[model samples]
Target: MLQTLKLLLPALIPSWRFFDWIAPSPRIEIKVNNDWQEFRPRPDHVSFPTMMKRMVWNPYVNENLFLASCAERLVDNPADQHSYEQILNRILADINDQKVTSLQFRLAFIHREGNALKKDIRYVSKIHDVSGAQA
Candidate 1:
């Protein structure tokens, strides 16, 4: 009975170990007009009301989170074509400019080193023609 109770105790109690080990996360960057930018850039400043609203309903934020998950998958499996295609489709959908004819994408691992953040480029895809490609 004591052994059974000990086994069940852990199940009943919650372990709030959220940050046991901090590691780098993968980020998707798209090259647009000779400049590379984050696929989904977060706003620098969000108001208290806006933060509360986003916590309740924010499709864009959710989509970005999904994309981040896909990026992590890509990092784990470099030959993951499904995740690669999903990221490409997302980038194509976001860029609706007529002037941009070609673009490239790369996966970057972002991590905090000491007090500074650093980005290390992992994979750089060949330039893709946007004119003939379908998202």
Candidate 2:
């Protein structure tokens, strides 16, 4: 497995910055207690690209592939109302594990228009109450 190799020989792999030039910069956000926070990986605190590249030994191995895939669907058709309850449920469980309440999920994209890059919020999930059954 890739995880096993990461532990045995960590120095062989290159950093995320090496492939940043070829990735699309996408913003992923999560809401806890009604507060929106950007989701960034720990330690290095690196935020991964929306569209991922398949590399055998990439440093961005810990990227949220689930979120990235879901985000792509949202970007492809912003108006499509898809039930991401499964994903939301997992996130809710994580929040509960952390002893937090209130939950929301959002994904944004940067659209290029001429020389300007515009931020477009493509997806925003409803605020779900963690106390009761998932909405």
Candidate 3:
């Protein structure tokens, strides 16, 4: 069933972002001391990351049909802004409570260009300062 849904999702939704035509990847980066590293759920961690991604991509984040909405701004929706902020705060607080010095989010996309085809981190969003953040 899941596989069928995944295969048919594109046809049901023609929007590129909705279909994830260009893979948009997100990673949480945490700073410890002076160095930064990727943050991953513990082996025991539950479905938090999946929930976060879903919340980020929910349609309430944007409704401006005029502007092309990028996957990076998933949390900028007006309707779900407050809820998204709460979820974000909880994640940040959890990291900080675990003694992480700082936190940020990085979003990247994979695509092909004129002559060469490659997969790499093409762009990263602005660094979010979650150092000593309570929320």
Candidate 4:
């Protein structure tokens, strides 16, 4: 019994090392016209009622989280075709304006430096046409 308890102790207790090597996460940005913008910009603020409602039901928020995961996967493996296509399709769907012909996207690593946040561009995709065509 003593040996069994000792063997299970490490598994039962959480380790601090889990938080020690946190790395920067990736963000997806799309360039329209000449300006770059977040693919899914977070709302500046949410009312208490809306926040409470989101706790139970929030498809948009869930989808955005999935997209962020895809961006992270893309950053880890630039050649990941599924993630690349998923991001491209999602961005294309969001751009409703027919006048917008082409757009570019890039992956940025966002990290904190002391009190300020910094962004480092890691990959910039070729400009793709909005009409379900890759350029």
- C-alpha lDDT score of every prediction, in listed order: 0.84, 0.63, 0.48, 0.83
Q: Worst 10-residue stretch by lDDT in candidate 3? A: 61-70
Cα-based lDDT at residue 56, candidate 1:
80
Best-performing candidate as measured by TM-score:
1
TM-score for each candidate, following the candidate numbering: 0.77, 0.52, 0.35, 0.76
Q: Candidate 4, 23: how far from true, in Å? A: 2.8
Off by over 4 Å in 3: 1-20, 41-71, 74-88, 110-135
lDDT of 1 at 60: 88
Q: Tell me how far the alpha carbon of residue 76 in candidate 2 is from the true structure, in angstroms, after superposition.
A: 2.3
Of candidate 1, the 10-residue stretch with the lowest lDDT total is 126-135
Candidate 1: clashing residue pairs, number: 0
lDDT of 1 by residue, 1-135 (tens): 998999799779969787799878778898888999887778899899998998889998888888888888887888989888888888888886546789899989989999999999988877988876543
Instruction: Summarize candidate 2's per-residue lDDT along 53-133 as a digit string, tens digits.
Output: 434445444446656666776667765455365456556655655645567788777667778888777778777766664
Judge candidate 4 against the unseen true structure and give its global Cα lDDT, from 0 to 1: 0.83
- Candidate 4 deviation (Cα RMSD): 7.7
TM-score of candidate 1 versus the correct structure, residues matched by position: 0.77
**Per-residue lDDT of candidate 3, residues 68-134 (tens digit):** 2332344344344544354355457557556554555432334567766654543333456665464
- 109-135: candidate 4 lDDT, tens digit per residue: 889999999999988888886655433
Best by lDDT: 1
Q: What is the C-alpha RMSD of each candidate to the true structure, in Å?
A: 7.4, 10.8, 11.7, 7.7
Best-first order by TM-score: 1, 4, 2, 3
Model 4 spans with C-alpha error above 4 angstroms: 1-21, 131-135
Worst 10 residues of 4 by lDDT: 126-135
